[model samples]
Target: MPRPRTVLLTGAAGGLGTLMRGLLPAYGYELRLLDVLPIPDEPAAITADLADKDALRAAVHGVDAVLHLAGISLEASFDKILRANIEGTYNLYEAARAEGVRRIVFASSNHAVGFTPRPMGTDPLIPVATPHRPDTFYGLSKAFGEDLAQFYWDKHGLETVSVRIGSCFAEPTSVRMLSVWMSPDDGARLFDAALTAERVGHTVVYGSSANTRLWWDLASARALGYEPRDDSEPYAEKLLAEQGELDPERPEHACLGGHFTTDPPIWPH
Candidate 1:
């Protein structure tokens, strides 16, 4: 198989974005990093807002595929989510379509399926291929992106994969993370599968690891040849003891993972 040559990556300044920028280059993809903030060290970084059609169009120029990571990520006011996540996503899709870009690997979030409940005893509870049950505005935006991917694939023939990413920290920090954390290596592999998978017209897969305590299954992503390495169970004992009490809510305790289903909003402004 021919290697993915040139990829246009957005949101390079963010955590996962930075990791992807570092890893993608090593995987033989000539990276064109994009973000509103300047990343001087990135070889081909472009400073632009994805919501701007003209800027997004310019960013999409001459790229074979787009690993779209740009967007607002918090469960804030509806207006904020609309402009950054919704509109920005639309601009990227339309721009990719116009540029004749064949593939799009979108950075959808676990929050897209956040509302799904998982019982405490079951580790492999929330299967990755399950239907979306978005919990917040941020998650709703991701749901929209997934639908948009379907629209683009059905109407414009653009191959797209919406990866509902879990916690992508350096290490599993809390009890819930034992079920939801996505190691950097696993995250990169997921992106690779999304980029190079054959006949993936439109698909949704969970972005997570092969953890023994994981709440999600990777059958969908397995078809794309993704084999994740890391497991969060190694830190399970330490995390659960440290995190104090687990929430009483079934949605909070169940496989869906995290406070995405909680009453009080937890996103930073």
Candidate 2:
């Protein structure tokens, strides 16, 4: 299939969304921005919460595909996570179905399988088939989103690509990040590939750059035509010097989710 010309970018004012806003247009995508927060310079952006069905319907209307990046991006109370991420995502998909939108690029997360042990030494890279092992309420919400995407595809024929994103930042900031960080440029490339890939029926791919020290496999994403151009190896020297070697005994270092694995549960508070 040809690349979608008009794309609906939810959470358009968030961190990743902001980065994508400036970059996706360069790929020839006409973006219709939406967010609860006001977009700084984009006066035409639809400022509405994802829970608002009517607003969501309006946003989905006339768009060729949706980049579903909306939702709480970090660990939060279960109530908040339920409302913002879970219900919010369901609402978005329902709206898309109602509006007859066919394709979606879901912004899933590595946290969905955060409790899974990270590969050590020459151990094989973690594949996309890994089972769910959510480390936080935020992670659980993403897991639900992936299942929802699958359900939508199986039942309603909606095509989706659920990108289980690692740490996406301008630069790799820590030794641990060296294994997971995805450069902004590679992030755009991965998303573009997901948007343009033909006949994707609820595919899931880890969103990362071609880092030499990566802990996850990119074969699934590569199959979608993603060619990551950046690596975190160059930042290894500085980060390793600052943070030192990871202690295998540490619980945080034991899993793919990092600090999220040992962090206090957010919902009971």
Poorest stretch of ten by lDDT in candidate 1? 248-257
The regions of model 2 sitting more than 4 angstroms off are 264-269
Instruction: Give the Cα lDDT of each candidate.
Output: 0.83, 0.93
Identify the candidate with maximal lDDT. 2
Worst 10 residues of 2 by lDDT: 260-269
Model 2, span 46-147: residue lDDT tens? 999988999999999999999989888888988999999999999999999999998999999999999999999989999999999999999999999999
Best by TM-score: 2
Deviation of model 2 at 102, angstroms: 1.1
Backbone clashes for every candidate come to: 2, 0
Q: Candidate 1, residues 117-231: lDDT per residue as tens digits? A: 6645633456666787888888999999999999999999998988988888789888777767899988988898889888899988888898776667678888899999999
RMSD of each: 2.1, 1.8
Question: TM-scores across all candidates?
Answer: 0.92, 0.97
Checking candidate 1 for backbone clashes, the offending pairs are: 118-254, 118-255
